[model samples]
Target: MCGTANPCITLCAVLVGGIDGLENKLPLVAGDCQREVADLSAEERRGLRVTTKPHISIDESLREFQSDGALVRGLETPLVSAYVSIMEE
Candidate 1:
């Protein structure tokens, strides 16, 4: 099933990528929509490359979530961990 089929997985995956991007100081790439992203040439798309792991399993995503710097300040680690654990099940 697609990740979007599970809201939990979808949200967690986005969070993982966002955290990684922040830590790496990745630049943002603006695409109007899926069509705009798809219309870009291979070279153009490469410019937006933040991570090679475009799709990851929930388990992989959880590992990132459990990492020391995965979440930003103000987000309680215990709560996030509990939430992710429930989603993984």
Candidate 2:
């Protein structure tokens, strides 16, 4: 895990990727997730390109928290991870 301690740092990012859902959860089996992956955000699509197995989908969600730079809501942790991007201000 990343260990950064800065009061001003306000972004929490989690890395979640796997094939066949690993031992964490079951594979999403409703809609054609991968077929539509090409149209997802650039970051979302990038995650799939690095996988070897082809039975998983990758997306991100945030926790129910607040910050000066960002806010995340995860009343219950979503099945997906979190993605954070910092832009020059």
Candidate 3:
């Protein structure tokens, strides 16, 4: 699944299965770390090597899935306890 060229497929799989499905494939970073990335200045974000423009708008694609009933629910709220646990480490 990780080798697929289409990121949307990967995202859809993750969305359907929840984050636990990614436990082996990726590290579980704290939600605060994610928020910090989101809060980064545009210039700071652009400086991150992993950042790239999506070929299609992910929000729009997700909306299409919602309209088609492919996605049963929206994303889960960030796990604050998980963040605290990470901080304690």
Candidate 4:
């Protein structure tokens, strides 16, 4: 989670997906990544979410980050700094 490039990007993506789930009131389901997504039946795929959405990247995550003011002040800066350090190299 730390010392990686754009770590928040990945975290944000996941949080965005979870936000989608919460917003949509989607039910939770267990999915196996070991199996191909296409191989899963519609029933098995229900409530499953991906880190990114179609036509959107980290933008959704940025929106999510912005909405939570308290969170952004403390947590995101360090992660963003790490990502910046990676880019500088």
Q: List TM-scores for all candidates, in order.
A: 0.47, 0.20, 0.22, 0.31
Models ranked on lDDT: 1, 4, 3, 2
Residue 41 lDDT in candidate 1: 69
The sequence of per-residue lDDT tens digits that candidate 2 reaches over residues 1-89 is 12332323332322222322454486654333465543466555555543322223211112222231212232123312222322111
Best candidate (score: lDDT): 1
lDDT of 1 at 33: 35
Question: lDDT score, residue 64, model 4?
Answer: 56
* Residue pairs in candidate 2 whose N, alpha carbon or C atoms collide under 3 angstroms: 63-72, 63-73, 63-74, 64-73, 64-74
Of 3 and 4, the candidate ahead on lDDT is 4
Question: Quick one: how many clashes does candidate 4 have?
Answer: 0
How far is each candidate from the true structure, as Cα RMSD in Å?
5.5, 12.5, 15.1, 7.7
Q: In every candidate, how many clashes are there?
A: 0, 5, 0, 0
Model 4 spans > 4 angstroms off: 1-5, 31-89
Residue 77 of model 1, lDDT score:
76
Q: Is candidate 2 or candidate 3 better by lDDT?
A: 3
The predicted structure with the larger lDDT, 1 or 4, is 1
Candidate 1 lDDT by residue in tens digits, 14-55: 787787788889877744335454355676666666224333
Superposing every Cα of model 2 onto the true structure, what RMSD results? 12.5
**What are the Cα lDDT values of the candidates?**
0.59, 0.32, 0.43, 0.53
How big is the positional error of residue 21 in model 3, measured in Å on the Cα after superposition?
Answer: 14
The numbered model that scores best in TM-score is 1
* Residues 1-89 of candidate 4: C-alpha lDDT, one tens digit per residue: 12332556766756766766787798766544566655656665664653333323344444555555444443566764554455545
